[model samples]
Target: MGQKLIVGISDWKIGRGDDVLVTYALGSCIGTCLYDRTTGISGLSHIMLPDSTAIIDGHTTRMKFADTALPDMLEKMKAMGAMQGAIKAKIAGGAIMFQTSNSKFNIGQRNIEAVKAALQKLRIPIIAEDTGLNYGRTMTFWAENGAVEISSTVMGKKMI
Candidate 1:
C-alpha cells in the first residue's frame, strides 16, 4: 500500500499498513504512540492536557485529555483486532516551555506525570520516551514499520 499521512492537534490516526500518523509542535503537551506489532496496527494521540475534569459533562472528544484519550485509544485498537498483550507504547513531547517561579501550573510536568499514571493504570509498559525537555517537538509514528520518529526545532529528528 501507499503511504498515508495525517496531521493536526488533538488528533489520532490508526494504521495497519504503510501509513504514518504525525503531530507537530508539541509544546507543553504530550503525544502517545500505541502499536500492535502482530497486526501492524498502530495509533497515536496528541494530547494538550492531563485531565478534562474541569470541562464538565465528561463527554468531550476522546482525544481531549491524556487520562481519557490513552485508554480510549487502546480500546479502539483492540476493537480493530489488535491484541492487548502485543501492544507497545512510546511517549514524547512534555516540555517545560517557559521558566516560571510557581510550579503549581507547570502544565508540561503535569502532562507527563498524568500520562505515566494513566499508562500505569492500564498496565501498559512504556518502551521508550523523550520527555521533560524545554523545547517543542514533532512526532511521527510509522505504523507500517512500528517506527516512531521525533523532531524538534532545537533537537532535530531522531528515532525514539
Candidate 2:
C-alpha cells in the first residue's frame, strides 16, 4: 500500500504502483476509473455533469464533466506510458438522489450513459461497473491491480 489519493467531487487524480485512489460521496455524479495493469498506472475522475460543452462559457472545472474528463484522462494516462489498448475501466457512482414525476433529475442515469459513451468512443472496455441506484457511493481504486472497492450506506461495501 502507498499513499491514499483522495479525489473530491468534480476532481480527478492518477496513481501508480501501490497507490490507491478514492472518491467520496457520489450522488447524481459519476466516478470513472481507468487502469493499465502492465504499467501499474491508474486514473480516477469524479464528474458532476455529462458534458462540459453544455455549459458554454459558464464556470466549470476541466475534471468536472464526462466529455472532457474522459478523453483528457486517457491522454494523460497515455502520456504516462500506459498503453491505450491495455487500459480497462471500472465505473461507480451515478446515483439518482432525487426524482419526481416529469422531473429532469435523471442526472445519474445520464451521467452513466455519458461515461459509457465516452469510454466507447475512446475504445476502452469497461470491465466492471457498479452504478445506478437511489443511494450515494464511495469508490476506491487500487493502482497496483486495477481493482475497485465500492462502499455506501445502503450497499455496505463491495468489490467491483
Candidate 3:
C-alpha cells in the first residue's frame, strides 16, 4: 500500500517497495513490465504502436512506440539503481479487439512482434506474457514481487 501509480496510454512509470502500477483498456496496445528483483524496482510501459519510424511526421511520441519507449524506460530504471542484467520483463495485452478484413489492419499482432523484438534487442528476457486474443485487457504490476496481473471482463483475472 505504498503508492498506486496509474500509467496512461503511451506512458511509463517506475515504482519500488509495495507500490503498484496500473494501466487500463489495452486493446491493440501493449503493456510491458520490467523489474529488478534485487532492488525491488519495477517499471511499466504502455505503448500504443510498434515503431516510431513509421510516422511520417518528424514529431513522434517517444513513449507511444515500443522501439523507443522500452530503451527509454530501461535508462530511467538504471537511474533509479536498477541493474540491466538483473531486469526481467513481463508483458500483457496486444489483443486484436475487433475483426479486420485485412491482415495489415491487425495492429495487435504487429504490436506483439514489435514489443518482443524491442525487448530482445534490450537483452531483457520475457519471463511471462498474456497476449494476443480478441479482448481488451487491464494490467496491475506489483513492484514488491514483480508480478503482473492481467484482467479482462471476458477472461476475469490471472497473474503472469
Candidate 4:
C-alpha cells in the first residue's frame, strides 16, 4: 500500500500505485470514484451539492457541487495520465438521512440524479453504484485495483 488519502466533504483526491482514497459519513451527499484501469489511476470526489448554479450567490466552493467538481477532478486525472475514454465510474452514498415530506427536501435523491447526469454529460460510463437509501455510508476507493468498498452502520459492507 502506498498511502491513504482522505477525501473530506466537498473535496476530491487523485491516487495511484497502492494508494487508497476514503471518504467518511456520507449523509445526503455522494462519493464518486473514477478509475482508469490501464493507467492504474483513480480519483474520488465527495460532493455536497448537486449544482453550483442553484446557488444565488457566486461565493461557493466549486468542489462542493457535482456539476463543477467532477469535471475539475476529471481534468486533473487526465493531467496525471488518466484517459477519458478508458475511465469508468463507481458511486456510493446519497442516503436520505432525514424523514421529509417535501420533494424539495430530498437532497439525497437529487444528488444521485445530479451525479448521474453529470457523469453522462462527461461521457463517463458508471460501472456500478449503491445509492438512494436511508442509511449513511463510508466509501473507500482502491487505486491499485479500482475497487470501491462501501460501509455503513445500518448496512454492512460491500464492494462495487
Candidate 5:
C-alpha cells in the first residue's frame, strides 16, 4: 500500500508489509525472488555471475556472483522467519544482450545456469522464470501478495 522502491544491481530487498520491491534492466544478470506466503515475507536478489572462483579474494558482495550470494540470501531470509520448505522462488533475467563471438563473455547465460543449479541443489522449486532472451527486463516482487512481475521493452509487463 506504499510507493514501490527500485532495487538496483547486486541489491537485495526483504519486506513483510505491502511494499513492492522492483529492479530494472536485467540483461545477463539474474534476479531471484523468494516469498513466504504464510508470513508475507519476501526477498529478492540481483546477481551478476554464477561463480566467484575467478575473484582473487574470497570476500563476497551482493552483486558479484550467484554462487556466493544465493546461499547468503537464503540464509538471511531464514533468519527473517522465512521457512525453507515454505519458500517459493521466481527468477528472471539472463538475456543475451549482444551477439558475442566469444563464449567466455556470455555472462548472462552463465548466471542463469548457475542460479538454476543452485536452486536445484538447495531443493527449492522454482515456481516461475523468465530467462534466456535477447532483451533486458524489469522485475518486481510484491510482498503483500507474493506476486512476481516482469517487464521488458520487447515483452511488456506481465505477472510471472
Candidate 6:
C-alpha cells in the first residue's frame, strides 16, 4: 500500500488496489468512508461542517461541508470506476470535543446527521460505523479489500 494517502480536514481520497486512505484528529468533524467491494475501489472524506448553505459570505470549499463532501466523494469514486450499486459506507469520528449546554449546535452530532442524510438521499447503505461520542478519532480505509481501521486513544482500535 505505498504511503498512506492522508485525507485532511475538508479533503477526500479514492483509489483501488492496495491504496490506503487516512484521516487524523477528528473533533466535531465527520469522516466518511465508501468502498465498492466489486471493484475494490474506496473513498474517504474528512468533512469539517454539516452544511455549506450557511456559509455564504465568501467562497468556501465544497469539501468542507458534509452535505457537499459526501456527494463529492461519491462522484469521485464513480469517476474512478466505482459502481454506486456496489458501494457501501462506513463512518467514524463525530465527537463532541467540548460538551456545551445552552445550544443545540453540537457540531459533532450535526455532522453525523448530515452525512447520514446525504448517504440516504444517494441510496448508499452504511454497513458499519463508530460515531456520536466525546472522543476524537483517526480512521484509515484500505482499498484493496474495502476494510476500515479506526484508532483512538479513548476507544483503542477497531476494524469495521
Question: In candidate 3, which residue ranges exceed 4 Å CA deviation?
Answer: none
**Global lDDT scores for all candidate models:** 0.86, 0.91, 0.94, 0.93, 0.85, 0.87
Better of 2 and 5 by TM-score: 2
Give the local distance difference test score of model 2: 0.91
Error of 3 at 159 (Å): 0.9
Name the top lDDT candidate: 3
Candidate 6 stretches greater than 4 Å from native: none
Give lDDT tens digits, candidate 2, residues 73-151. Answer: 8999999999998999999878878766654878888899999999999999999999987899999999989889999
Per-model TM-score on C-alpha atoms:
0.93, 0.96, 0.97, 0.97, 0.92, 0.95
- Tens digit of lDDT per residue, candidate 1, span 69-143? 889888889999999888889999889888889897689989999999999998888999999869999888888
Which residue pairs in model 2 clash with each other? Answer: none
Where is model 4 poorest over a 10-residue stretch in terms of lDDT?
52-61
lDDT for position 151 in model 4: 93
What value of lDDT does candidate 1 attain over all alpha carbons?
0.86
RMSD of each: 1.5, 1.1, 1.0, 1.0, 1.6, 1.3
Q: Please state the error at residue 92 of candidate 6 in Å.
A: 0.7
Worst 10 residues of 6 by lDDT: 98-107
Query: Residue 83 of model 6: what lDDT?
Result: 92
Q: Quote the positional error of residue 54 for candidate 4 in Å.
A: 2.5
